[model samples]
Target: MSGMDPSAVPGPTVVDRRRLVFGVLPAAALLAAGCGRSNDDRSDGGRSARPPLALVYNGPQGCPACPETVAALLRGAPRPYRVEYVGGETPLTAAALADARLYVQPGGGADLKGTWRHLEGSAGAIRNWVREGGGFLGLCFGAYLAGRNPGFDLLPGDTNGYIDSPGATVTDGRDTVVPVNWQGRPRHMYFQDGPAFFLDPGADATVLATYPNKTAAVVVAPYGKGRVGVSGPHPEADASWYADKDLSNPDGVHFDLAYELIEATAGRR
Candidate 1:
């Protein structure tokens, strides 16, 4: 978290609890400890450990749950991951993403234009990166931003087309718990007014999951040599999210799904 500022996103919700839960432990440390962060992992290895997967964290949209997203990825990732936070003065650049294997756009509540502005000229870089076999994961707002916007248009054929963006794809600003049919079972997950993919005819995207309305809740599309996956709900929601929403998952079925999502995005790598 040294190179990133979790508090940069101005809002009442953007809290930095990453340090509290993670402390001096790096991502790999948390993994060795167990599914939950434990003090035992601290003595396992030095902080110089570098995982095979490299991720870029896009933080310009002022995502309050950005840190939580990172925590979930670290806890559930199939392989070791290294994250590079991109935003503020340190704009997301082609050079930065050159060596990264995956890029994650965390959930946030901010104007698309303003959020997209952070990567003004970096869209092509991102597109090219993924097109060359890199991976991209968009969560909630990140999924919405990936649709065709005023910027580079990472995911085209979106129903909104940058006009009334988020257009008929979502229930305008509505945040609530919703049921998602994943694989083949129903899973209750946290849904903020996230984009339900309405791909145009002949769209190359593949539906990974669907909402009750049959609208795409999660999708993976091929862009040249790379692949991009977007999810309309927060599978990585932490305990605080469930507590505030008065929701419970005794079996932790939803939590395990987060790892599945990550594996799907990581693809064969």
Candidate 2:
């Protein structure tokens, strides 16, 4: 990873959590009505009281599989949790995040700048929310958005395409599985135009996984009192996403990696 000059990037805007609470309550209420049904919906014979929510961005900026795949992964978490869709018609407002334990920004198409355009409105809200102890998980394109340039500036460093990194194995944007060392365990995970994180000097970010090139592929860091986790691969991807690609994970479909990320970002691990 390369060192970045922290001064070159704007830092997070400080906001009083108390003021944010009172300001967005009404908007959050209206936004919640349009969110997706919880995994614990009573109509599905699940518990009447919904568990804590994980709000996922399902807007046009994200790929078709991004939102649903992530929601499926969240449903398999160790603890009880609910899934809610945000973005597009349902904007991600401060109120919408009030009750959410986590906010996920999934992989999108290759256009990072375009994705930021759609998400710029919620940038301040997300930054402030995470600072107040809410968790954030970014996957693939989402990880790119966690950087300083064309992103939310959540990380002290910057992000670049993994395909262009030194010693990178997968050199294209095709759908395929690539080699990764996840916490010292060898594994193959779905990859596309993922990102390689470059932390600034002395930044206290934890590297959870690495590309074959040994660049940071997955990392977790502190944002005020909250936590931020970003992955360069698609751990939330399901079998359906691999169809016709002739690709497969020897370990089969699993949510372990995704769950690990959730747990870490939510401060449960």
Name the regions of candidate 1 deviating beyond 4 angstroms. 1-49, 159-174, 249-253, 267-269
Candidate 2 deviates by what RMSD? 12.1
lDDT of 1 by residue, 1-269 (tens): 11123223221121111221224333321111001111111121354656645554546554444644554555345565655567644567888777777777766534555556666677888887888888888776677667764434667455231112332334423334667788788777766556677787888887878887777788888777778788877777665555544456644534667766766666333
The model with the greatest TM-score is 2
lDDT of 2 at 106: 76
lDDT value for model 2: 0.69
Question: Please, what is the TM-score per model?
Answer: 0.73, 0.80
Q: Tens digit of lDDT per residue, candidate 2, span 40-93? A: 332223677766788989876524545666776787667646788898778999
RMSD of 1: 10.2
Flag regions of model 2 displaced more than 4 Å: 1-49, 267-269
Model 1: which ten-residue window has the lowest total lDDT? Answer: 29-38
Per-residue error for 201 in candidate 2, Å, reads 2.3
Task: Give residue 45's error in model 2 in angstroms.
Answer: 6.0
lDDT of residue 187 for candidate 2 = 80
